[model samples]
Target: MAGLEVPTWDPQTAMLIGAILFEAIILYVGYGGLEKLVGPRLMELLVGGESGVSQ
Candidate 1:
Protein backbone atom coordinates (compact mmCIF):
# COMPACT_ATOMS: atom_id res chain seq x y z
CA MET A 1 0.00 0.00 0.00
CA ALA A 2 1.27 3.50 -0.85
CA GLY A 3 1.44 6.03 1.94
CA LEU A 4 0.44 9.67 1.54
CA GLU A 5 3.32 12.10 1.69
CA VAL A 6 3.02 15.26 3.74
CA PRO A 7 3.98 18.57 2.22
CA THR A 8 7.09 20.29 3.53
CA TRP A 9 7.17 23.90 4.65
CA ASP A 10 9.33 26.16 2.53
CA PRO A 11 10.55 29.32 4.21
CA GLN A 12 10.67 31.33 0.99
CA THR A 13 7.21 30.30 0.04
CA ALA A 14 5.96 31.08 3.52
CA MET A 15 7.57 34.51 3.39
CA LEU A 16 6.01 35.22 0.01
CA ILE A 17 2.60 34.17 1.22
CA GLY A 18 2.98 36.27 4.35
CA ALA A 19 4.00 39.29 2.31
CA ILE A 20 0.98 38.93 0.04
CA LEU A 21 -1.32 38.56 3.04
CA PHE A 22 0.21 41.61 4.70
CA GLU A 23 -0.23 43.71 1.58
CA ALA A 24 -3.85 42.63 1.26
CA ILE A 25 -4.56 43.56 4.86
CA ILE A 26 -2.82 46.90 4.47
CA LEU A 27 -4.77 47.69 1.31
CA TYR A 28 -8.04 46.72 2.94
CA VAL A 29 -7.43 48.90 5.97
CA GLY A 30 -6.10 51.76 3.91
CA TYR A 31 -9.02 51.73 1.51
CA GLY A 32 -11.47 51.43 4.39
CA GLY A 33 -9.99 54.47 6.10
CA LEU A 34 -9.86 56.39 2.85
CA GLU A 35 -13.49 55.54 2.19
CA LYS A 36 -14.46 56.74 5.62
CA LEU A 37 -12.61 59.98 5.03
CA VAL A 38 -13.91 60.65 1.53
CA GLY A 39 -16.99 58.53 0.91
CA PRO A 40 -19.57 60.97 2.27
CA ARG A 41 -18.07 63.95 0.47
CA LEU A 42 -17.85 62.02 -2.76
CA MET A 43 -21.42 60.84 -2.46
CA GLU A 44 -22.62 64.35 -1.78
CA LEU A 45 -20.75 65.67 -4.77
CA LEU A 46 -22.11 63.00 -7.04
CA VAL A 47 -25.66 63.17 -5.70
CA GLY A 48 -25.65 66.95 -5.46
CA GLY A 49 -26.18 67.64 -1.74
CA GLU A 50 -26.98 65.04 0.89
CA SER A 51 -26.28 61.31 0.53
CA GLY A 52 -29.27 59.55 2.02
CA VAL A 53 -33.02 59.46 1.94
CA SER A 54 -34.68 62.86 1.57
CA GLN A 55 -38.01 63.88 3.09
Candidate 2:
Protein backbone atom coordinates (compact mmCIF):
# COMPACT_ATOMS: atom_id res chain seq x y z
CA MET A 1 0.00 0.00 0.00
CA ALA A 2 2.28 2.67 -1.31
CA GLY A 3 1.41 6.32 -0.69
CA LEU A 4 -1.11 5.27 1.92
CA GLU A 5 -0.68 7.10 5.17
CA VAL A 6 -0.88 5.00 8.28
CA PRO A 7 -2.56 6.55 11.29
CA THR A 8 -0.82 6.50 14.67
CA TRP A 9 -2.14 6.60 18.22
CA ASP A 10 -1.58 9.73 20.27
CA PRO A 11 -3.27 11.86 22.93
CA GLN A 12 -5.81 12.86 20.31
CA THR A 13 -6.84 9.25 19.73
CA ALA A 14 -7.11 8.67 23.47
CA MET A 15 -9.25 11.76 23.86
CA LEU A 16 -11.44 10.68 20.97
CA ILE A 17 -12.04 7.24 22.46
CA GLY A 18 -12.65 8.73 25.91
CA ALA A 19 -15.14 11.16 24.44
CA ILE A 20 -16.97 8.32 22.69
CA LEU A 21 -17.11 6.24 25.87
CA PHE A 22 -18.31 9.19 27.92
CA GLU A 23 -21.01 9.92 25.37
CA ALA A 24 -22.14 6.31 25.37
CA ILE A 25 -22.36 6.22 29.15
CA ILE A 26 -24.21 9.51 29.23
CA LEU A 27 -26.63 8.28 26.61
CA TYR A 28 -27.28 5.07 28.54
CA VAL A 29 -27.93 6.97 31.75
CA GLY A 30 -30.17 9.45 29.99
CA TYR A 31 -32.26 6.74 28.38
CA GLY A 32 -32.58 4.83 31.65
CA GLY A 33 -33.71 7.99 33.41
CA LEU A 34 -36.19 8.75 30.65
CA GLU A 35 -37.58 5.20 30.76
CA LYS A 36 -37.99 5.45 34.51
CA LEU A 37 -39.77 8.76 34.06
CA VAL A 38 -42.02 7.64 31.20
CA GLY A 39 -42.32 3.89 31.53
CA PRO A 40 -45.61 3.90 33.41
CA ARG A 41 -47.27 6.30 31.04
CA LEU A 42 -45.98 4.33 28.09
CA MET A 43 -47.29 1.09 29.53
CA GLU A 44 -50.70 2.58 30.08
CA LEU A 45 -50.78 3.85 26.55
CA LEU A 46 -49.66 0.54 25.10
CA VAL A 47 -51.81 -1.67 27.35
CA GLY A 48 -54.95 0.40 27.17
CA GLY A 49 -57.83 -0.19 29.70
CA GLU A 50 -57.35 -3.97 29.62
CA SER A 51 -55.66 -3.66 33.04
CA GLY A 52 -55.09 -7.36 33.80
CA VAL A 53 -55.98 -10.10 31.30
CA SER A 54 -53.23 -11.00 28.85
CA GLN A 55 -53.58 -12.50 25.44
Candidate 3:
Protein backbone atom coordinates (compact mmCIF):
# COMPACT_ATOMS: atom_id res chain seq x y z
CA MET A 1 0.00 0.00 0.00
CA ALA A 2 0.99 3.62 -0.51
CA GLY A 3 -0.07 7.03 0.76
CA LEU A 4 -2.94 8.62 -1.20
CA GLU A 5 -2.80 12.23 -2.42
CA VAL A 6 -5.50 14.72 -3.30
CA PRO A 7 -6.13 15.33 -6.96
CA THR A 8 -5.19 18.69 -8.50
CA TRP A 9 -7.19 20.62 -11.10
CA ASP A 10 -6.58 19.80 -14.77
CA PRO A 11 -8.23 19.14 -18.14
CA GLN A 12 -9.55 15.87 -16.74
CA THR A 13 -11.64 17.76 -14.26
CA ALA A 14 -13.16 19.81 -17.04
CA MET A 15 -13.89 16.67 -19.02
CA LEU A 16 -15.44 14.99 -16.00
CA ILE A 17 -17.61 18.00 -15.36
CA GLY A 18 -18.51 18.19 -19.01
CA ALA A 19 -19.47 14.53 -19.06
CA ILE A 20 -21.69 14.98 -16.04
CA LEU A 21 -23.25 18.06 -17.61
CA PHE A 22 -23.86 16.17 -20.83
CA GLU A 23 -25.47 13.31 -18.95
CA ALA A 24 -27.74 15.74 -17.17
CA ILE A 25 -28.69 17.37 -20.45
CA ILE A 26 -29.47 14.01 -22.01
CA LEU A 27 -31.62 13.08 -19.05
CA TYR A 28 -33.40 16.39 -19.22
CA VAL A 29 -34.06 16.00 -22.91
CA GLY A 30 -35.25 12.45 -22.48
CA TYR A 31 -37.62 13.38 -19.69
CA GLY A 32 -38.81 16.35 -21.68
CA GLY A 33 -39.55 14.15 -24.65
CA LEU A 34 -41.36 11.69 -22.46
CA GLU A 35 -43.34 14.48 -20.90
CA LYS A 36 -44.36 15.83 -24.27
CA LEU A 37 -45.33 12.37 -25.33
CA VAL A 38 -47.39 11.61 -22.23
CA GLY A 39 -48.06 14.92 -20.57
CA PRO A 40 -51.43 15.43 -22.24
CA ARG A 41 -52.59 12.01 -21.27
CA LEU A 42 -51.46 12.58 -17.74
CA MET A 43 -53.20 15.94 -17.60
CA GLU A 44 -56.38 14.43 -18.95
CA LEU A 45 -56.28 11.73 -16.38
CA LEU A 46 -55.54 14.11 -13.56
CA VAL A 47 -57.56 17.25 -14.42
CA GLY A 48 -59.12 17.06 -17.83
CA GLY A 49 -62.70 16.47 -16.75
CA GLU A 50 -62.76 19.09 -14.05
CA SER A 51 -62.89 22.85 -14.54
CA GLY A 52 -60.34 24.67 -12.48
CA VAL A 53 -62.38 27.87 -12.17
CA SER A 54 -66.08 28.57 -12.33
CA GLN A 55 -67.42 31.41 -14.39
Best by lDDT: 1
Candidate 3 clashes between residue pairs 3 or more apart in a chain or in different chains: none
lDDT of each: 0.90, 0.86, 0.84
C-alpha lDDT of candidate 3 relative to the true structure: 0.84
lDDT of 1 by residue, 1-55 (tens): 3668777989999999999999999999999999999999998887777756676
TM-score of each: 0.81, 0.70, 0.64
Q: Report the C-alpha displacement of residue 6, candidate 3, in angstroms.
A: 21
Model 2 off-target regions past 4 Å?
Answer: 1-8, 49-55
Model 2 lDDT tens row, 1-55: 8879887779988999999999999999999999989987787788865353476
lDDT, residue 32, candidate 3: 99
Sort by TM-score, best first: what order? 1, 2, 3
Model 3, TM vs. native:
0.64
lDDT string, candidate 3, 1-55, tens digits? 3568776779989899999999999999999999999887787787764443335
Off by over 4 Å in 1: 1-4
Lowest summed lDDT across 10 adjacent residues in model 3 is found at 46-55
